[model samples]
Target: MTTAIVPDPEAIRPELAQPGSALPVPPQGLRASRNAGFTSLRVGVTALWLSVIVLLPLAAIAWQAAGGGWQAFWLAVTSHAAVQSFQVTLSISVVVTILDVVFGLATAWVLVRDNFIGKGLIDAVIDLPFALPTIVTSLVMLALYGKNSPVHIHLQHTPPGVGMALAFVTLPLVVRAVQPVLLEIDRDVEEAAASLGASGPKVFATIVLPSLGPSLFTGAGLAFSRCVAEFGSVVTIGGAVPGKTEVSSQWIRSLIENDDRTGAAAMSIVLLSISFAVLVLLRIVGGRAAKREEKAA
Candidate 1:
């Protein structure tokens, strides 16, 4: 009788023992993965691209702001136009955020929790700002509120007109952000709260509010950023009055138009810094809220 010798399975696949490929072959029934390292490479490339496009521009402005040292940066931030623009921009953004949250939450709740005739039309209308150009929105606002229009008769002197226009421009942002979150929320949870003797307000305050917290903050942060950086819409209706209505973006544009590149760069950096700080704070708060929701779930 003749006997045949067979090599060991492990020895036959010696490549498995190499430094990088130390793992054994995946299960016999499972197919081997192709280019498993490709994911990491793709992530690296994406990160590099973002740094080049976003971070580098930000760094350049910051570098210029610091060129004359901290004293110069301080002056840029505290200068008359800079200070006034900051105050006005921040105040308007806060007001807009509050109003948007209230209206957006209510709108989202109605859209997701109730059924009505023309629901589809209402939903589509919520996103009108997304399709409309910002400049066009400004023009419409100007047409309606620029002293000649009937609506402007009462609102001509007040900031209310500009505020209303900015709100309309940013409405879709808040609604879109909150709608998905509301849709994902469990209807049964609210019903359970009711079954447990919780009243409507109590159920909303204790359950629904917490669930909606992250989305609200996220949306408000985005809306605030958009509003603060807004140029076309605000300028078209705001009149860009330096101490009265000039926003940071318009102020920066004026500086650049006057050929004060250094000053414009400095003002832009200041605006960017403040906006970035606010956005980061919002994101941190949103993260905490998300964690609480996860825990409750």
Candidate 2:
């Protein structure tokens, strides 16, 4: 038999001769470290952007709010006009959100699953709210519905007019949110349900609604927040009627006009807190729904 020669283990690779051979690291480890560094860089950039854009402004508001102490903050947020403004804002937001959800879903479904003439025009028009300045939107509404117009419904200086303006502004949010989710749904699943004798409503209820729940809620929360903070349109259309049509944003503006900066900041904080709470609640509900859908799948 020929003698078999075994090459020394460390002869081929010099790294293997060291006491802590593994410490030298492999090519894969180098790539992993590079990827980790890139990820860290991305995270740092995002944090910096958020701090400058969102966190800093919020901190400034909070600090201003706290400058007057708890008693002043509490009084500012709870005064009679403030309370009425909050009520008006919440009520209109609720109405606008409901209408937006209903019409937005229908519009998204039509845009996604249907074909028609003028479809492109309609799709472009849906984004008009986003493209138009909010003040311009109020002007448009005023022109169309003011007392002098042919189709005048006299909506100016009313809660209904404010709601209308807000709904128009927020319409695109829900439609855009639900549209992508609708596009991602598999058509064959709906067909299969139909072949199994499921009615249209049954298929939609069982197959479509659950998948859309999270996105719909997310869009509603966004719309609600927008409605709450709506300033130009609400102020123009509603005219800041103290006990009747005044909303939170109008109230804040009035406070600022009166040179009550601390009160304005306090009221802003209250509005921000409410919006944050509602958004958090929606997120929790959406997460649970998403988890349930995953489990079912």
Candidate 3:
């Protein structure tokens, strides 16, 4: 009688016999076969939508801005009014981002770590700025803090008014960003620190702040970009005062009204470029911070 020889499965696939071994990669043909046609269609549709809404508009603006030579672009961006508007826009954006980071962090921490009555209500109200129209927010600020109000402070037509409006509109960005990070944090880690006799400030500085750094920077970057593009609120409150309260958006509007389409496009490109650079810088810094936190962990 001839005996049948059995093949050992582990001998055939040595990786399966080892602990903590990675699975073998599938063949290219098998991997390709696993992708659904519906997934490809969905990806194509998403790309088409993004191209229509974002890429096309940006390309059009760039083409318009470059219609004239580089000399024209430089002159347009460096003009007196354009320079002043850029300054105003940058100043307001910086102030708004700073304030948002401070108050937003506190609010996010409270919402995530504490339990209380009306917590749901407070959480819902935090998104009020996003739900309300920018123009409506401007009007509310005017009503509360404008001239002849009970508080008797005149913020309208001033830099502070512009900053306040920007801050109000972007307030929720930081809170929303930080809340998710806070919720994901392990409470036991905090408890372990406390049990080691670490003070509240020390614990936060050593542990909490390191973990939260990336999210805070990301939120601030988003808020700053939104502030740079703010129009309705700043126009309503800041009044487009020449060399004073006029921001880049209002300045671009003025240029377009005067039939300076090239100038307006150039200024728009400059503002867009600055916003893009800041966002890129923030991402790089945030990425580094996240890596450091992971290494420390």
Candidate 4:
């Protein structure tokens, strides 16, 4: 009979035989295969989770939005009050986004670069909206800015009040998004550009803005999407004044209260559509900016 020989794993992997480093080591191919399997499993789990939480709910809404057919959906969305709500929601959301971008950037810059008394308190306070309930925020707004206030400034039942409430809720989104990016920015590059005779605005426009493009878009998109469906804060302040300060969420509620489920679904669909469209637009804009960055590199 012929003698049989088998290769030892320790011999195959010399590092495994090293003193104080003696450990079983899988072959490179096996390790790679295991990693690939784990990656696939993780991908599948993520898809399933998102489907259960986000996709399924969105599909249900879209299905309900079409419950009465396209004609009914169109009528529901185009009615006078519905159109007014759309206008108010869109206009306020746009203003909120612009304000968030400008102020969010400034707030993030100060928080990252400047140091002073109460700075830590200000940092924590920026996230207060995230912890506070939206209804409580509205209530606070009513107490401080509503009628019967010591300040004597009433904003209840007004569009600007609604806008202000939205801004308050969304401020943190932009700040948190931009703050990390601000910290990661290379000040040496800015100093280099300045040394090369680049003016302040020129340095910011060239060096700072490009790096911040994606983060700004992310923050703005989140703020816009969240504010679109914001119910508690806006509803309390705007008073659901139809064709005046009424927003999409309030309009949808009114529809449901009036036994118009289909109309409410249709209105909800409109808000979803607007949010989705804006996200897509931002994605495209950001992608193009990234390509430009690659080319510049």
Candidate 5:
């Protein structure tokens, strides 16, 4: 058996190690050390911030909810008022989510595909809800659609009023989510499908809808979540009408105001559970969408 020998590169290229040659400024080890330090610092700061701002508060709410024991918690969450609030919230949120998904998609399409006068203003106005205070938003809705002579529309102090208010605040979530996805979609595919005798709707349903499924789910889910906890918007327009329009958040606030901390905590825990469920569903749907895209690709 014979073995091959490796050549000494330094011996063959003496100029490679000549003096006064430039080297890395801080050396690799020192650079790595600094990078590691910076990474550790960033992680530490992020963990600390999340712990103090988010995790700790959620843990505290859980602890408070647990203090009332299982039976009391159940009663608090299942009492007629609580059940009514949940029903009202869930029902209206369903309607609101449907409306948001439909109109939001239309709005996104127009914003991306249409060129019209004041398009820039319309686009900027889409974010107005995000910047405006919820109370202010409520007031604006009430003025337009409330019991008045201007529009001859009276949705004030009703479930429809509450739904309109929520739709106003949450429409932006759906629009923004779908807008970016729309911008990234390839128009050539749509054009090619149309040229292939696929009608406009057919092309959109087959070629576009699949790509937008995840974003629609994301935007609709977020809008529904926001609808669940909406307070100020409904407070004035919906008026916590118990079995009619009182949302989960309004009910919780009423509980707190009536000095029922245990009940408040219980209701809060229920809302948290609902949010967690939405999060889980979003994760499952998002994962399935990713797998489908991978398979298609």
Candidate 6:
């Protein structure tokens, strides 16, 4: 029938009046205000710097591309050389991406999971493409596969010319992208899969492949874009033969050589557009895959 008695309001002291916090209160007024202003200034300067260096170029390119009216843009995209170049670039990029995915995964897995006598040397060699000039890779491929080359004597004639060069440059991209992700993966998961009834292929397909999908996709997209814009390497090795080996970049070079600046710019716009489109599509797919994984987890 009786209620509990309530404590007095005046019993609470000033120290106990405020909400609990781990950090002590700072001296207020000018000092705190100046500190906040300095922090804001630093953030603003960093953002401004990045925008100038990175976003400005992108904005310039976009402005140039859109300078041509919609009709001109449409005409540029529909031209025979432009269409052919698009097809060729896309085809080669796809081919190289697939090759890089297979070989890149293998190389990343070996570098991350396996430790052999020449492991460090092998890892260093994988990054050779990053340091070596693209022209060098092109020359090497030409020397390896061209008609005058001794290595080509047995094969006689194989269209592996352009593909070989593109793959060489893209190999480092895929390997580097996947290597970090592979290194981050827990070895225990792989070991557990092995301990189960899973065989080598089974473990890789079910366990490793799923985890590597995002990095593999990012690497593939990067490789594809690189192949699409590739100039020095493919041009030296493949020779821009229209209806055959003429990639977008090579086609642009040829156009410029023929003193066709407008057409070259137009074609360059096409290449940039396709690259942006593909990149967007890939990012969307990667996002969906990430969400699905989150739900599954």
For candidate 5, write residues 64-136 as lDDT tens digits.
8889799989999999999999999999999999999999999999999999999999999999999999999
lDDT of 2 at 209: 90
Candidate 6 TM-score versus the reference? 0.79
Tens digits of per-residue lDDT, candidate 6, 1-297, equal 999988765354444454653334555786789899999999999999999997887677556555766777677668898898888888878988899999998999899988899999999998888888888887877777776887643211233577888898888888998999898888788799899878989988888888888888889989988888987777667877786787888877777799765566677767777788879988898899889979999
Off by over 4 Å in 3: 1-40, 286-297
lDDT at 172, model 5:
94
Worst 10 residues of 4 by lDDT: 16-25
Backbone clash count, each prediction separately:
0, 0, 0, 0, 0, 0
lDDT of 3 by residue, 65-109 (tens): 999989999999999889999999988789889999999999999
TM-score against truth, every candidate: 0.82, 0.86, 0.84, 0.85, 0.89, 0.79
Tell me the lDDT of model 2 at 275.
Answer: 91
Error of 2 at 172 (Å): 0.9
- For candidate 2, lDDT tens digit of each residue in 148-235? 7678588888888888999999999999999999999999999999999999999999999988988999899999999999987765
Candidate 1: worst 10 consecutive residues by lDDT?
A: 28-37
TM-score of model 1 (CA atoms): 0.82
Over 4 Å off, model 5: 1-30, 291-297
Candidate lDDT values, in order? 0.81, 0.91, 0.90, 0.90, 0.91, 0.80
Worst 10 residues of 3 by lDDT: 14-23
Tens digit of per-residue lDDT, candidate 1, span 1-297? 999999787677866565775666666445433454666788899999999999899888877777878776777778888888888787887888789888988898899989999999999998888788888887888778776886545343346766777799887788888899888888898999899899999999998887788888888888888888887777677877776677788888887899766777888887776689878998789778878868987
Question: Candidate 2 — which residues are off by over 4 angstroms?
Answer: 1-34
Q: Candidate 2, which ten residues in sequence have the lowest lDDT sum?
A: 17-26
